[model samples]
Target: MTERTPFRARVHAPGAELDVQAYDFESPELIGGDDRARLDAALEAWGRQVGMLITAKTRAVVDVATAPSRIQSFGAFIASAEGPVLWATASSAGGRILYRIPLEEARYWAARMIGAAGDAAGDGAPLTSVERALARQVLTEQLAELQHATGGMFAEPVLEAFGTEPPSSVDRDAQAVVAVIGTLRRNDRRQLAAAIDAELVLQRLGAVAPHQDAAQVRTRIGGHLALAPVEIALRFDPTRVGPDTVLDLAAGDLIPLAHLADRPLVVTLDGEPVLHAAVGGNGERLACVVVSNGDLV
Candidate 1:
């Protein structure tokens, strides 16, 4: 110790140690791989339609691409959205979901619509009244494409509202299948993301396959109907009679009907006409020979 002349033996500490991060929390919710893959396929089809719509509307060739999707809470998705974005809210059978595109993208559409310089877009400025009008029109049309794209995923999804600011109606905690859509950007292509309800899609896919054969559906319906019994009525045109004629009805009284002889009569089920038939005999039992058949009303 005497040899250490006025020197301090100090252990230099590396400040306060941060608590070691460990796998201490439950994993976030996510759709399974197979389901996610199926969803992606459906979304890819939708992107193709959108591209066609834009190309048709603008008379310009624009390709649309779908990026690999992400699963996260709507809150996270909304918060992470950078810069000004126009959000179009759509109410579906699942729930109210959001569709978002950068305001710059909206301006791009507006520019093309108004026959302005399409190359000069995204000035990082708010849309004027006229620009907003044009943006709204294109977005409304886009939502129609969304309807066709999702099929029955959304039922009559009327565009409720749209603006640069996020509406308070969105559920913050709801997990979403956020899709990144890339189309006609000022810089060439935009990767705008929109949140779709994961629960809705999973539940729908779990219930029904994306494709169903029409013939198979008809056969299924026919099989079900064959086992069901229904009361059927044969009718010709009604004979108009006074109330006195009804009250004075007698046994074996003849009343002429409007039906012509040898012509097919209307066969009805539950008061709606569904078939044409002619009176006939089947092994001594009276029967109606079906001449034509149709769907029940």
Candidate 2:
């Protein structure tokens, strides 16, 4: 037996934990070219409505504009989004959406809500109790009304809560998309970002049943064609005979056809073979049941 050296244990460092919030976004994008284009068109209309609503409610003069949409996870959206925001959770039948407006703009809106002009917590401080309550009331009602009036993506949005940060229950990994609504007032530009439910947006974009459209077209054309009356004729393979053979044929003369007796005959529509059928008798009338396209023997 050989002598062994003293054994020693070595410790290994644990693998670095994955920080999802800080994770780089190398993943495939959610929306595609056509969806983006459709969203853009919808946003254009939405902007007009939003502009009118803002002036009506806030009494603030701001130019509302639409920004192109973005696709990302909730975590990524929160991570990359800049500035402190006032967040509200809007729930409806369709689903819930997280809306965030920069504190600066929120202050502006809050100020106007309580009959003030750009004077509600403009120093990056929290909104006053009265200002916050009024903000919540206006936000929930205005957003809900916008959905109903537009008859578009959202339904009746009931605000669940308003806070300095998003609710803790919101899944960081949940798929989400962002839409920015820009406003300009008194030379101030601000963007309000909404981390909307990805599925809701996708549902709106693809609400049209494009896959069934072709079937509908086929059914429509078939229905119209079925209404038209056409002369149909049963045909058999023609016999290839010389002109002299035809001339020799006389009364009571038997002319053998080239078609095989066992084989099915062709049913023609407008001189085109649309179906194949076997020779049969139905209630003493010559008839046939349609057969397979391949060798209807």
Query: Highest TM-score: which candidate?
Result: 1
Clashes of 2: 0
Clashing pairs in 2: none
Off by over 4 Å in 1: 1-29, 184-187, 207-297
Candidate 1 global TM-score: 0.56
Q: How much lDDT does each candidate structure score? A: 0.72, 0.70
Expressed as tens digits, the lDDT of each residue in 31-123 for candidate 1 is 557766777776777677777877766667877789877777788888888878898887767566688888877786777777876676466
Candidates in order: C-alpha RMSD to true structure: 29.5, 24.3
- Candidate achieving the largest lDDT: 1
Tens-digit per-residue lDDT, 1-297, candidate 2: 966433222222346443333323633466678777777666556666666767777887679887877767777767766777888888766666787777776666677766777653467688788777766765676566546444565666778879888788777787776777888877778877777777777776664344567788997887766655455567898789889989999999988899999777897766877678777777956766667444433
TM-scores for the candidates: 0.56, 0.56
